[model samples]
Target: MVKIRLKKFGAAKRPCYRIVVQDSRKPRDGTTIEEIGTYQPVTQEGENQFTVNEERAKYWISVGAQPTETVKKLFSKKNLNKK
Candidate 1:
């Protein structure tokens, strides 16, 4: 099954993540089908926490991609409610 999930990256102490579409059985940072957004923790004040292409996200959902638990929570936090 195709899954929308996070791909981790960045240095040892600093972390960044790319929200991507990939097969559910693959590793978290393995081959991806598409990139949908990004997430960065606030190491400093007032940094952009996350960004997502809403239209693309909706398109992927329509095509039957399922979001991971974390991704689903992110969507809910952004009021992007999905089934």
Candidate 2:
């Protein structure tokens, strides 16, 4: 099954992630179908986060891409409201 999930990257102490579309069975950082957006944690700046390409995100959902629990929460927080 296709899924929307996070692909972890960056240095050990400084972490960053790319939100991507990939096969569910693949590794988190393995081959991806497409990159939708990103997420970054900000300890220095309060409440710094965002999501992009909501239209594409919803398109993927319509075509049967599942989302991991964490991705689902992120979508909810962004108000994507995909089902």
Candidate 3:
């Protein structure tokens, strides 16, 4: 199955993540089909901690790409701002 998920990056204490489209069976940081955004968990909320292309994300989801729990929460936060 294809999925939309975070790929861990950055140094040990300062981890960052790249939200990407990849196969579910692949390793967490192995390879990605497309990069859609980023997230930094340690940063304050709304302090440039998350960045996602909503359009692409929606499209991928529509095509059956499952997002991780964290990614789902981020999208919800983004949508709340549009309301």
> In lDDT terms, which candidate is top?
1
Each candidate structure's TM-score, on Cα atoms with residue i matched to residue i, is 0.90, 0.87, 0.86
Query: Could you tell me which 10 consecutive residues in candidate 1 have the lowest summed lDDT?
Result: 74-83
lDDT per residue for candidate 1 within 5-67, as digits (tens), equals 999999988999999989999998889999989988746787788999998888888889999
Q: Which is the better candidate, 1 or 3, if ranked by lDDT?
A: 1
How far off is residue 36 in model 2, in Å?
A: 0.1
Better of 2 and 3 by lDDT: 3
Checking candidate 2 for backbone clashes, the offending pairs are: none
Prediction RMSDs, each to the true structure: 1.3, 1.7, 3.3
> Where is model 3 more than 4 Å wrong at Cα?
44-46, 80-83
Clashes (backbone N, CA, C under 3 Å), per candidate, total: 0, 0, 0
Mind giving the per-residue lDDT tens digits that candidate 2 earns over 1-83?
99999999888877788899999899999999999998876446665665668988999998999888888888998777555
Candidate 1 versus truth, CA RMSD in Å, comes to 1.3
Once model 2 is optimally superposed onto the true structure by TM-score, how far is the C-alpha of residue 8 displaced, in angstroms? 0.3
Q: How many backbone clashes does candidate 3 have?
A: 0
